[model samples]
Target: MKTPVKSLISGLAPVLVLAIAALALPAAQAQTAAPAASAAPAGAKKIIRYAFRIAETSFDPAQITDLYSRTVAAGIYDAPYEWSFLAKPMQMRPATAAALPEISDDFKTFTIRIKPGIYFADDPAFKGQKRELTAEDYVYSLKRHYDPRWKSGNLYILENAKILGLSELRKKLIAEKKPFDYDTPVEGLKALDRYTFQIKLAEPAPRFISSNFTDGSFTGALAREVVEFYGDKIGEHPVGTGPYRLAQWKRSSRIVLARNPNFREVYYNETAPEGNARLQAIATKLKGQRLPMVDEVHISIIEENQPRWLAFLNEEHDLMEEMPADFAGSVIPNNQLAPIYAKRGMQMVRYPRADVAVSYFGMENPVVGGYEPHKVALRRAISLAVDVDREIRLVRRGQAIPSQGPIAPETSAYNPKLKTVMSDYSLAQAKALLDLHGYVDKNGDGWRDQPDGSPLVLQYATQPDQQSRQLIEQWNRNMKAINIKIEFSAAKWPENLKSSRAGKLMMWGVGWSGGPDSDTFLALGYGPNKGQANHARFDLPAFNKLYEQQRGMPDGPERFAVMADAARLMVAYMPYKVHVHRIFTDIAQPWVVGYHRNIFVRDFWKYVDVDLEAFSRSKGAAQ
Candidate 1:
C-alpha cells in the first residue's frame, strides 16, 4: 500500500518535489550558536506571533467548520486522541484518554477511559472551584451536535455513523420543538464511570475513531456547566483542559492565548521516523523539554496576501503558515528557497497538503439546479467550460496539481491512476451541450438564456481579496468563451460561509481539508450531509447508498471499489468542480524552533518553541 506522502510525491514528482525539506544553511550561519537564555531577564515571557489568512467564525468546536477557527479551538480543547507531534506516516496517540480506545470485534462499540486529574482552566462557571474533566463532558459535547440550537456543521459525520438511540432522541426533540436534554442518557453514548465513556453504533464504523475522535478541534470534550452558563455566547468563552486557554479575542482582528497554569506535565518525547534528518534533528534538540515551551501566542487575521507576506518579511511575525501563491515565484523559485531568505537563515517547509479546492452549484436553485436531464446537462457543460489547468498555472502560480476527483491526494480512496472528465476543459463540447439543452441566445443577445427564455446568469459568492479577484477574472474569461453570463457576489469569508450553509447562495467556491480517514471527502455528496458539509445540497439516493456502504466495510478492495463508484457519481452529476490539490509552503524565522507542517495535526502550538533571547537580538538588529 502506498502511503499518502508517497502517493502525493508520485503524483506531483514531475512538476514539484513533495518532500518537507528544511532549507539548507551556509556553514558559517549553521555553526553560529543560538543566543543563551541568560541574555533575557528572568521570567520574561516567550511569545510566538503569526497571522491567519482568513477570519475565524467561532471557537466552539461544534459551531466552527473553517480551518482558522478549528486551529484556535484545538489549542483550547482536549480530545480523546491526537496525532503524535513528531511521528511520520502519522500515528494517533492518547490525548485525554488513558490509552487507546477499546473496540468490539464488529467495530460497532467503542469505549474510552479518560485520564484522571485533568482540570479545565479556572472559570466562573465552576463557581470558584477547580473543575476536573470527566467522561460526562465528552458525552455532553457529542450530544450538542444533535441539538438544533447549535446547528452544528459536523452533525452529519455523527449522524451518518448511526449511533444507537441518539438520532431518535434528536428527532423526538425536533418534533416536539423542545430543547435537547443532555442529562437524558442514550444507548449509543454513555458515561460508564467517572472517567470512562462508551458509544454503540447501529452499524460497524471501521474508521470512526480515527476519523472523528483524533482531532480535538472537532470532538473535544465540553463542560455542561460551561455550556448552560454561557448559553448562546459559548463560542466566545471556551474553557477546556488543554495546554492553552483563550486569554483575549478581538473577533476578526486579533486573538491571544496564555499557557494553562494547571495543565498536566507533558514532556517533549516523540519518536521521529527514521531517515528524515530534518525531523530527527528537531527531536534531538527539543527532547526532555516541557510541552508548549512558549508562554503566549498572538494571532492576527490578515486576509490579503501582500500585507501578510510583508509582515513576515519585516520580522513582525515569527512564522508564515501558508505562503501566498501570488509570491511563490519570488519566495521559493523552482521549489528551492531564494537566496534573499536563505541568507537570513529563514527556514521553509513545503508539502502537498491533503485538500481540494472546488466550485459547487446549489442543487436547489431554480436556474442551475434540478435532477432533470437538461439541468444535469447544463451543470456538466459549465464544468467542462472551466479551464482548471489555466487557473492553476496563472492564478495559483503553478503551486497546485489539477484534482481529478473529490478525493484529495493524501487519502486511501485517492487513486493516482484515475482520470475523469472533472478536470477536462473543452469549450466546443460545452457549447454543444448547452445548445442541445436549449440554452441559446434566443433574443439575439450575446449571452445565452435559459430553456424558458429567461436570463441564465450564474451568481457566484466570493470574497473581496486579491486572490478571489484573480479567480473571478478567470471565471469571467472562461464563461465568456462559451457565451454564458455570470456575476459575482462579494462578501467576507464568514458571511459567505453563513450564506452557503443556509443554502442561500447560488454557487460558491471553497476548500475542504481531509483528516486521517478517507470518508470525509465523500461526505460532501452524502444526502444526510446536505446543509452541513454538502454545500451543494445534492440529494442523490444512489450516491448516498454508496457512501453508507463504504463506511461500514474495512480497508480493503471492497471499500475501495465502493468509494470509486461514489466518486464517479459525483463526477457524472457535475454538482462540484474539484479544481486542484494545493501544495503549501510555510516559512519560519531563525528564532522560531521546532516548527513543522503536519497535515493531520492542527493542535501544533503545543509542540513548538521560541528562542526568546534570539528573538530579542533579532528585534534589536532590525532596529
Candidate 2:
C-alpha cells in the first residue's frame, strides 16, 4: 500500500485533545480511540464509551470484511505483527512473534518464532489447563480460511501468495470428501517445535508480511480446541491473547469488552516519525506507559446517523468518530468547530482518511463487462461523466479529495502526477465518447441506445440510507447530462456484497481501506481474484501477469513502477471509476486525554485513558 498523504487542517491542534469539558456522555450508541488516559479529575473512572453507525456483523475477521467487524476483532485477538499505535508510517512490529520472520534469500521461506509465555484468555475449552499460544496454533488458525464449510472470504490472500502446500491440501480434502485433520500437518506450513513455525511459499511472495499473512490481530493464532469447542458458533466465542476479551454482546445493539486479566503486561513505547513534530511531542507523554489505561470499553450500535449524532451532542458519548458529512457545515462550519460544540469543549480534528471510496463497474456482467469497443466505451463514458468534483463539494462537503487512481493518498504507489481520464469530469467528452461508439438516441425517448439498437439501462446496487439516496441522485443527474439511463436498486451493504460477488450487481460503489502495501489496490483488478477481491471481475491476462510480478517483488521503485503500469491499464479500461478519498473529523471531550486517530489502525482501546472525575465535575457544574 502507498504511504498516506497527510491531510493538513491548517489551524487544527497537533495534540489529539488536551481537554473537553462536558457533562458525562452515556458510554454507548454515540461513538468510540487513542492511547493512555492523561491527568484529569482525581480518581476519575478510566472508561471510554464509543459508538458506530453500522452494527458489527461478525467477530470473525476470517468471515467478514466490514470495518465494524475488524474493529471488534482488533481487541479480541492478536496478530503475529502489528502496526505501531503511534508510528505514522505504520511499521509492523512483533505481536505474538518474538521478532520479524527469518527469511531465506529467495524470500519464499519465512520462519517465525512465537514468543514463549504468551497465553490466550482462559476459556472453557481449556478444560482445566492453561491455554498457551503455540506455532501450531498459528498454522491451525491460518488453515481455518481454507475450510470449505466456513466459506472464509479471506482465503484469496493465502491462495494468491501460494503458501506451500496449503491450497493443494485444501483442494485434496475438498475433492476426497474428507474432513480437514488439524493434527495432520502440511509441509508448507509446519510447527517445527512448540515455539517455532515456518512457512514455505511456492513463489517469492514479498508482500506476505503486508498482506493478511501477518498484519492485524485477527490473523493471530487460533486454538483448534477452542474453534471445535464453539463449533459453528465460533463467531460469538473469540479466544485470543489480546489486551481485552469480549464480555457482553447483544448483537446489533451493544458490546462490552473487559480487560483481559490473563493478558501479559505490554506498554506503549512508540515514537512518531521525524517530520510529524507534533505527534512526536505527544508520544513523549505516552512513552513507557503500561497500556490498556482504560478499564472497560462500551460500544453501542446506532445505525442511523441522526440519532448517533444526537447521542454525541447529548454528551452520552466520549468520542464521536467520522461525523456525518451531510451536516458537516452545521457542526464544523468553515473548517472550524461550531460555537455550540466549541463552547461545550468539543474540538474538530481533521485527519487524513486512509481509504478510497470507489464505484466499480463489474467487468464480467453482460451489461457492463467486455473487451469490445461498445462495452469499453460505455464504461469510459460513465467514468468521465461522474462529477467527483461536485461529489467533493456537495455530497462530501469538501471532506474528501478526488481520487487520482486506484491508490489513494497516504499509501504506497500513490503518484499524485499520474494521469488518468477517469478522474476527468466532462459531460461533453462523455457524450462524444458514447457517440463515437454508436451509442445515440435511435428513438425519441431521450436516452441513448446500445450499438445493437437495444434500450440501454444500467442497474446499480445501493444502500437505502439518505446519504446513498442523495449520492444516487447525483449519479442520475450526471448520467442524465450524458443521456445515459441508469436505475438504482436498494440493498444493505451485506446483501449488495453478495450480489456483487455473485456477479449479479452491474455497478456499485464502496470504500477500500488499503493495507500497508500497493498490491491491496492492484489486486482489485487481478484476474485470479475474480469473484473474490476482484469485485469488478475484471479479467485481463496482461494485468494479472503484472500483478503477480509486483506481488513477488519487495517495496521499492522497481516494484512500484510495475504496479503503476497495472494501475495505468486499469485507468485505461475504467473497470472502476475513481471517486473520492474520504476525510473524517474525530471530536473528543475535554477530559478525554491521550487521544488521536491512527490513519490505518483500529486496535487502540488499550492505549486510550479516561478522566471520570473531570467528567463528573463538569456534569455537576452543568446540573
Candidate 3:
C-alpha cells in the first residue's frame, strides 16, 4: 500500500466481500486452492509465494500508484539507478545505467549513460523484433507523465522538479487542446546519443536523481511501440527489460511472474554494510548467484487480516509482509518473535515504517473545508477532539507512534525533536473552540450545528474492514464527545481512492509512505500539487513559498528550517489530521533466504532465493 506521499495513494488494504468468504473457509481448505508445496522433480522450477493485503491496480509504471502494483512493476522494469539492497545508510547504485549520474556543479543538470545490449521482454508490439532499450526510451517515458491523455497521478513529482522545457511543452499542448507531441524536442530532457540522456532542471535540485529516477516503479523506461500498441489498455500490458515477466494475472485474486528468458545476466553481488552481521551472512551466501534466484513468483491478494495471516501460517505463502496489528501481541510479543515460531526457524524483521496515517479534509468541501477563521476552527476542533493515543493503543494495538507533523521518519527533513499540536487530544478545548466559533446546538438538537444554523454533518469515507470499523468507532466516540454529527460512507479502497482524487470525498483516512526524497511528504500540502499528491487540496501560499525555498537549497540546517516552517503551516491549517507513524513487523519462513525489508528499495525479489530442500523438509516434518 503505497500512499500519496509519492502520489497520494493509499497503502492500506481495501476489504472486499470476497475476503469474508475466504474467512469462512478453513485454513487447510484455503491452502488447497493455492499452488502445492510438494517436493519437485530434478530440474524443476523454484517458486517463492507471498500474499498482499491489498490488490494491485496496474502494472504500467506511468499509471499505477499503489504499493502492490509498484512492487510488481519494480521487478519487471529496469530504471537507471536503484537503492542498494543491503546498504545500511541507504546508498544508490547503477541498475541499467553504466555508472552514477554526472551532476553539474549547480545541481541543475544530470547526465546518465545507459549500458548497451539490454533488451525488452519479447512482446507482439515489437512485431517479433528485438527491442533494445535506449536513452530515447527514458525520454519518452518521462514525457508520458506530462501528456494530458494519461492523467498520470505522478505528474506532480516531475512538475515539481521544474525540468527546463518539458513543463512548457506540456502547458503549450494542453492550452492548445492538441495531442502531446512526443517527437517534439525539449531542452530540459533530451537523448544526447544512442545510450546517453541528459536532464536540465530550471533550478538546483540536489536530490532529484535519487528521489525520482532511483525507483524503477516510478520512472521506469517504457517502449514507445508498446505504449502505442496497447493505447488505452497499456496499463494491463506492461513490457519492460527486467529480471521477470508477467506470466499470469487473475484480476484481484492472484498474479504470477516467471523469469524473463531474455533478461540480461545480472548476478547477486551486493556489498553488506559494516558491523551488520545479518547482511554480511546473507551477502556471503548469495554472492555470485544469478539474479531472481526463484524460477517463479506467486502472489495472492488476501484483504482480510486473519486469512492473510492464516495463509502464511499454513505455508500457503512463504512470507507475511506486514504482521496484522490484531495478532501482534501473540505473534511478536514485546517486539520479539514468539518461541513457538522461533523454534521453527521463522525470521522476524521489525522496524518503524517511514509513513504517516492521515485523515485529510477536502479544502473545497462546504462542511469541513475552508481557510476562513470559523472553518479553520471547525477542522482544528475536530482534530483536537480525536484521541490519537487511544487509537494507537486500541485500534493500532500499540504498534504505532503519534505523528506530530507531515514529515515522515527516516528523512533528511524529519526532526524528531520538533513537536506541535497536530496530535493533541482534548475534548474540552475542542468544545470551547467550537463554541467560540459560534457552532452550537441550534433548534434544541443534540448535535452541534454550523455557525449559520445549518446541519453540520460530516461525511467521512472509509473501507469495510475490521480495522476500519474499529477506527470508525473511535471517530464516533470522539465526535460524540464534541457534540459533532458525523456519518461514514462505506466503499472499497479503489472506489474511495477514485473519489478522493476527484475531491468527491469530504474526508478519508489513509496512510502515506515516504519515498527516498524527504520532500515527498511535504508535497502533500503544496499548492500546485492539489488533487495529485495534495489530496487535501491545501492551497496556502505561505506554505508553498517555504516548500519551494527548501527545494533549491541543499540538505542542511537552512533547508531544514524552511521545511519545519512549511510543516508548521500544515499543522496550523489542519487540512490533514496526521495520526501516527506505524511500526511494521514482517516474518519469513525458514525456506526463504536473504529476507530483509529495505525501506528505500522496492525490488527485493531479485535478491531473495528459496531453499527447496528446506521447504521440502518442512513439508515432510508437517506430515
Candidate with top lDDT is 3
Per-residue lDDT of candidate 2, residues 1-623 (tens digit): 11111111111121211222122222211222222333465554577887877777677656766677777788878788877777766777888889988988898988989899998999999997888889888888888888887787778878887887788888888889998766667778888999998998889976576566444444766788888899888889888888888999999899999888888878878778788765677678777777788877889987666666667666678888887776666667787887756766675678766577888898877778898978888998998899998888877778988777887677788887766776798888889989999999999799999888889898987887767777888999999998889999998777887777788888997777767676777878888887776888899899899988888887899999999889888988889987877888888876676787876677767876666766765555444
What local lDDT score does residue 148 receive in model 1, on the 0 to 100 scale? 88
Cα displacement (Å) at residue 128, model 2: 3.4
Clashes of each: 0, 29, 5
By TM-score, the candidates rank as: 3, 1, 2
Give the Å shift of residue 437 in candidate 3.
Answer: 1.4
In model 3, which regions exceed 4 Å deviation? 5-40
- What do the candidate models score in CA lDDT, each in turn? 0.84, 0.77, 0.85
lDDT of 3 by residue, 1-623 (tens): 14542111122332432243244334324334555556745786788898877888888777887888988998888889988888767888898999999999999999999999999999999998999999999999989989988888898888889998888998998899999999999889999999999999999999999888887777898999999999999888888898889999998999999999888998998889889899899999999999989989999988877777767777888998878876666667788987657766889988888888999999999989989999999999999998999998877878999999999898877888878999899888999999999999997889999999999999998888778888889999999998998999889888888888888989999888867567889999999988787889999989999899899888889888888889999999999999998888889988899998997777678889988877876675554
lDDT of 3: 0.85
Using all chains and alpha carbons, the TM-scores for the candidates as numbered come to: 0.93, 0.92, 0.93
Measured with C-alpha atoms, the lDDT of residue 360 in candidate 2 is: 88
